[model samples]
Target: MKKISIKIVYKTLLVSTLLTTFSCKKVFDVKPQDQVDITNNYRNVYDANAAVIGIYGQFQTLADRYIILNELRADLMSPTANADQYLRQLNEHAETTDNPWADPRPFYKIILNCNDAMANFDKMVADGRMTSSDYQQRYSDVGAIRSWLYLQLGIQFGSVPYVTDPLTSIDDLKDASKFPKISFDQLLTNLIAFMGDGKRYLDVYSTSVSTTGATNTSLNTTVDGYATNLFFINKRCLLGDLYLWHGDYKLASAQYHYVCELGSLSTNGSWLYDQYLVQNGDGNNHVDIYYGNSTDERTLVDNNNGGWRAIFGGGVGTLTGQEWIWSIPFDKNFLPQDPFVNLFSNTGGSYLLTTSQLALDNWNSQTQQNGLPYDARKLISVRTINGQPVIMKQLYYNVDATSFLPTSVLQKQGRWLLYRGATNMLHFAEAACNDATLGTSGVKLAYALTNVGVTRVYDNTWPAASSLPTDRTNIEQTFLDAPYNLDGRNGETPYYRGLWYRQVGSRTRAYLQPLPAALASDKLGMETAIIDEDGLELAFEGQRWGDLMRVALRRKDPAFLADKVYNKLLRDGNGNAAAVRTKLMNTANWYMPFKL
Candidate 1:
């Protein structure tokens, strides 16, 4: 099924007038609200489940705005010629209160929905319609969602109103100071506490699907019966992420290690990783796990257009269970338009570009093998259409190449990935690097973590379909077969290699994308190794800006941010790089100012 068709019992409700009022003033003034009948909705577990689905639905509504706010503020993408004035302002870091994209209403709306779900779910438990354990699980789930929303709001908007209660009447809004705005640090503190609650009730394990009768090829090929478990937030992933944001390296590493180790286990009880290979006509190879593999049952024309692909191109249960930890699913029936396609697809109109040297240099690495000297992620990550590169990883359905118009099939809907194994692996590596107690083990873990993603690139060509290359020496030799290898990094045995040999055409600082020569004098000589790895492993996935923020904040150096973004703009050849840099260097420009 392209969408999870659980018939939601409660209607999708938004306190639209309240949201508007909240956005317009520091103190919310509301008229007496009319009492609406709502008691019937929480009478049973089934209805409570429907309320949970509605929470997920609220996330769906925030998806496009999420990507826009996160990505545009970073340097990974450029405003297209078709970009509206508001987009141009955002891309240039000149956004003010008037920019619609900077509005905090969306985040508040999701938080409001979470508030309602929590209140109603509590009632369900009190009424004995839901078990206590189930109630705890539901609370944990909703809390994680709410915490994440606040974290993002804190990231984009420096401080935001922290409202936890559902406003049913004007009385709830009367206390202006009750909704005190909190800082990002405070927000992280609250988020960590919320995810701690999640850890107590949520299981790290996902339920593998067993029943299967659908004729759709993808559904038939599912590794498990159903993968509904991957849709909601997992405690380990959320905890790890929240801890990382809080700079609690040891705790973050622990959480990330749990997710990475768990991700290695198969839901269907097979190999450690969900691995697949697709051989191109030229005998070149690409990993299906990276670009996403579609079986005969799960193609653009089919009903089963989901799995991890749902995080990008919409479809929920596409893959049974592999790398994707959590995602938001969208269907055209519900959203009316696929925002990803609307923004990046050819048939749709937009002018975002990834043609910068930073993007191209990484694309040229030998390890990212879509083809020799061209990482497989190149074409998939950013497609060069009409001699310009635009983001393409999320576009995976029926679209005319020339026209770039996506069909209205539910398959064309894109998903939003909250967390994945690759990102977690890198997170563990970085967190371990920051942790002193791990000692030598931390170094090895860091090396292994880097290899985990790099290996996926070259592992595609090992030429053995019957077995995974378990031999460390054999894996090293296969990678060494390439045109270039950093000879000194290869230790005595394949298992001991801590430094990977550099590939041809790759810069020394390529892995940890160094600042351009213009900013080299700034002496932030520090390559953001983990952030670089994240770019290669999860580009255009909407984490680039967050990665930048993590580094800048961790070191207490706005120089890192000023250098990376400003230097890119200075070299952008747009003739206005200086003007953009002026706006971006303000530090205040780094975050969206809150209105109301």
Candidate 2:
């Protein structure tokens, strides 16, 4: 049977049994059924590995879903067509009344499963069935995943429960009324300590940490393939993330840099530094692994109306570039489609391109750096259908024959994007090219904090040129300086949280949207946590929303950018995507409903 069906059945069983909450008391009290017997399952490494892998798979889905709350909590997007209204209440920017699940029910399920697995795993070690080395790794893997999830929860909910012991009954698990809560800082501090312990174990286990980074396809494909670890990427990702939450930027940077170095390491001990690659084969280009070969890989369409082909408001997306330090590789298992066609997509209404102030500013600023052509690395190209050439963006060939644009190409509606075909967006956005005349028209913001809320306008006039620094760190910092919402530095003060919303594509800040009496103070009155949260939460996700309260606690009020982005493109599903559509229509979107 298809894993899809199995997944469906799993969810059905779980949801039915867990309407309000999974009652651990109920699980222990119920009659046992045909569950996989763990004793025999532990004899060999194969099944044991699979078990660990299973933990990883469950972790991936929920973990992926869990992060969305942070995005919502930080005002990255408002609840629209898809998320439960309860979730929308937590957007933090909004004057929310309440919801219960936000208390941490579902995510805990994932945590419990991991812990349960760890328990069984530790038993295997105690019996001498497994080596101490294996045992240590298992501990680290659990710590990594659990730490990650808990940290996210802490950030999303100021105080959340810190559950280490798996429940005696699976039934007692779901009763939200019975769950405990902890302060965000406390939970974070505790997890940090746990990770520190796990790190000591990890150090003694491996001869030396094998730091090779992973591409998206690999991690997504083997969603639960880690027994000792969920592959190096997650491990690397965890370590890097851990250091950041601990307020150890230098260590955090080192952790990420360590992975980057491992990725570049050669057998001879030399390093293969970044190779500057641009989309050159077609007018529209991207840096992506465009296909996957796994029988269970994520394909373009789930149904006739499903698939990447159906999601395009413009063209579907493609991956191609230096933007990704390390991504899933393009192999038989991934990179299934022709990346070029998807490049021309318009990503639903996001392609309207009227008020994306931040992108415009970043592009112009980056381009002007080092006296390079005023055009930033993100180029615009337009070509003829018959392999002919012309001034790109000329109205004649503009629509379908273009290249990279901006973040406004997608908007949230249940899922931020809803694209399907790679070609649907081909002919859109042709109207604006070097649109020196582009103004803040159709910039219909539903609400703003004061005036425009947070926003930034780009004049399109190339910035004053400066010399390019050869140092990679310097280059990264330069990109960091762009006045756009990013995820690495401080950003959470009310002022910072409201920055992007305030800059609604006008040089003049936005007008005020009435504040609720409940709101503590004016946005500007806030500290810089807004900037810090933005830097951390939206670091690579193509976003800038920061869970400001976390910032209020972390830095204690005032915050500023020191740094985030979201899904700009994808080559496959779960690190393994279907073939790239060479002849499909397109519409583009940023997110999809639950992978199922």
Candidate 3:
């Protein structure tokens, strides 16, 4: 049993407290706490609110490490010449204990904050300092944050000390007898049970408090008057992820389905299905692609045109709100400044990471529905800056529109996207494809979701439907029923369209052709397509390695993940491709060394 020293706990608490004190002043409107007296802090609702904000402040520190560890270890990202030895080691899957990102202390610091807050929140409710409603909402919020951090720990470290009670010192974690380390699978079970069925958690902040000028100002309001859903975690999405890792396909599908339904309700149907796609000149729905004139022929669309890049660029408005489920905002004015500007920007940034050549090849291999030779998303995702290809999604705000290049002046503020619409739909499709109860219908539904979307008119008579008997041709009707139906289709005299009618599917939205008809019966092939689509849509947003790792672990196929990373390195002309592949073929080698 190795004694891991989490010396950052007190330091993180002090830093996060100071950071949240100023950052949350505009929104929560609470006074700064110069000192965090954990025993005496739960005096009122304001204190509870500040505590939760502090947790987020600490969690925000993990943004850079999260993206770097998740993306670099997997495909789609390569270290640049300017990248330090640590970055190169991470990319090569040969990280040593000296790598700062390998330390688990930062993650536990946030978890410790969560545990302390939840304990005090319960006491606040019991002492009549806060209402039970407020306690439940805030407690569950912190609990979800803890669960998410543990999940990341499990993903990156293989096994971790599962601590729930607030600790007096980090040294207690060193004693294996007192706090036993648990495997990733056991961690999932605990998280799934802790998060529950998602009914107990509050969907949004509903507390009303009296402000100086206004009476009963709802805390559900946006941050700094911006319509952003960046402050809290989505309970259902976290539970869905837990179940997905736990191998509970039906439960995972249900959780993801709830998120989709919530998205529909929250955005008034605009966020549903492929409604985000625009109707192009071809009379078909497609992701808004910006093709410049013949002389400067390249994709250069913006948020105004509903381009795919809008998902990452603009303020948290309609375009971003529809896609980004949960995000962590980092501003230059805040204590923890935006980290991406330094990692991704070439003009004013260190330019440590870039899009791998394999990702470019993956995007270039696709033919769009318009008969274009390459995927339009690549144009929006990666742009050549200073003769080097940089991930442009998060750096859009710091780039010049006319030249579509990084600007010399950088505004160090960005959002770390956690969960979103496309991810929800993809997870649902993946779960449905695996659930035996759904059968071949699940495969068709999954394919349709990633391709052209499910519709009774088009999909009912789809050639793939033949795989199911006449009686079960409409077997997907089960999903069409209440609670599960994402498609707005139902039996009525004058039929009104559901969410699926507007759904053009992820691939179709990217202007890519639908998968082959034969894949409808091939579950493995369908899963591969879904994972590939994940790489295309969610690249560099920090979910790549997890997606690949989850699928590989599920199928017990290390080669599935190994081959991809090997191909990425090989394409980049890295000599370590074979060695990396050989190492990754062993499941134990997938995770980093668990050190404090």
Candidate 4:
């Protein structure tokens, strides 16, 4: 009943590195016949325990890739700095797509994993290494995992080869020659049905496990085998996330909401972590997902690749956030955050990344007050420099994309409240209040207001003040000049010329940074075109070029600034109508093609 964050037992999935691995050992290696040496060896419960533990091991690998690629997919357009960038590309655009190179991987890679688990585990469930036993009964239970994996791929790609013929699709017949995904929605429908069948089959089998005399007495054995079921059960939650991607918010909301009900909220930190054999792998070293570091340890799970010191300079800060809900915990024995990881995670564009610099003129100045009160968040929430409440000065106030940053700007020491897994108790005190002024849709907002002694029916809609909230026209407005000089204690004044970023008056002028395409090459391992403009959201906004695409709101050009500034059609003196028409006609060539 104790809440435990899933991070302790989670892992990302991966296909075998060489064309032969399917997360764990090669499927062929685990084929019933190949296991000829091991099956006869499970004479005790310990061996059986390994079988289940292996399943969790594989889940960790699968989970890793699953979680990271998603970091790419977070909804950016929405308030969350999140975006389905890749998925959006896949969905909105077609054949002349930016990333067709990935066209079939998501589907097959998963199928390969599911199939591998099934084939290997099938032999054991049969109860006999050879002679026919209850294999059919257990196969369905195992199949649930496979079915759900297929569902994830199907929902995203539309058409996927069904699991009914997984063996033939992957083996007897060359999968290389077959299309891994078919674009019709029906594949999604069928795959979902398969998942249901697998789940039902599993439920019945679970009941059987509970009653049968064949069961072993060791509790850990049961817990370990739980991995197989974990793989399938987690899929149910995935189905919810997938539905949200497809715009079925109603269904998606219900799915997530339901999972919250069934799967008790995860505890902040968990201790049931697995330490795989991958050296330099950040996956382990963190025992649980509880908020705040119980002890600091560096992990393969680290964002910076062991170079935080040289990169971000020195002890910057640890990565902590309310959004993590779950995270790889670090204890010294487990992978802990190193000073290096701390340093790298701290560097940002300017005042945002650096620690307090009293050398600057106003470093010791009294805290600055919020210039605008129309928006209650800025007025009542954040604090001033010396010691008073004021609007938050950081860009993307509620969000921190960069992990490395000074504790001052990073808001590390405090804000730890967000990481608390406790329920009923408020995590964000601000959201609990109903600031008659803060645009909120319900009383939840008012709860926080009472702490301020204000009371009223919580208004759920955005208050008029928020509709057109006022912010510094540019970063410079706060300083003596414009964007370049630093008025805040957090950083040194920055300056650069023609580089598209530099100190100007008091603000950092906003312009599209040059994307030197030449820097890209197979040898360099850098992007051919810095799709991430590296301008507006430099410090932590993951990629920039994608943002320009979203901001311009042009479905046609994934290329930056050009769409917003270049009005090709009106170019006669005004603009060239013919040129504009020509570009529009050539839709396929517009977006900068990423070298996959």
Best-matching candidate per lDDT: 3
**Predicted candidate 2 versus true structure: per-residue lDDT over 481-553, tens digit per residue:** 2211111111332222211211221101101112232221222222232242232212213223333332333
lDDT, candidate 3, 255-304, per-residue tens: 78766666445545444444332212221112345444313334435442
**Model 4: how far residue 124 lies from native, Å:** 4.3
Candidate 1, which ten residues in sequence have the lowest lDDT sum? 277-286
Q: State the lDDT of candidate 4 residue by residue for 310-415, as single tens digits.
A: 1111111222221122221111221112111121122322211111111111112212122211211121112233332211222212223242224343332211
Question: Highest TM-score: which candidate?
Answer: 3
User: Which stretches of candidate 3 lie above 4 Å from their native place?
Assistant: 1-35, 197-199, 207-219, 267-287, 290-305, 404-410, 456-458, 463-495
RMSD in angstroms between candidate 2 and the native structure over all alpha carbons: 18.2
Off by over 4 Å in 1: 1-36, 169-176, 197-199, 204-227, 263-265, 274-321, 349-357, 365-374, 386-388, 398-411, 439-444, 452-527, 579-586
Per-residue lDDT value at 102 in model 1: 85
Judged by lDDT against the true structure, how good is candidate 1? 0.53
Q: For residues 1-596, write the lDDT of model 1, one tens digit per residue.
A: 01121123211222122222213321112223412235344564444544565566556666667777777667666667777888877767778788888888666766766787788777778877777766776677777788878878888987667777775432343356787777788888877876775446656423323224322211112122224456577777677778888878788876765554452344553323331111111111112323323222222221123222322333333441344677544443344244677677554535443434556565565442222344444544666666666676656644543344465434455455666656666676666555556554344334434443333223434223344444445443323211112121233433453232221111111122222323211213213655666766577667777888888887777766666666556556556666666665566667877875
1 against 3, candidate with superior TM-score: 3
Residue-level error in angstroms, candidate 4, position 9: 18
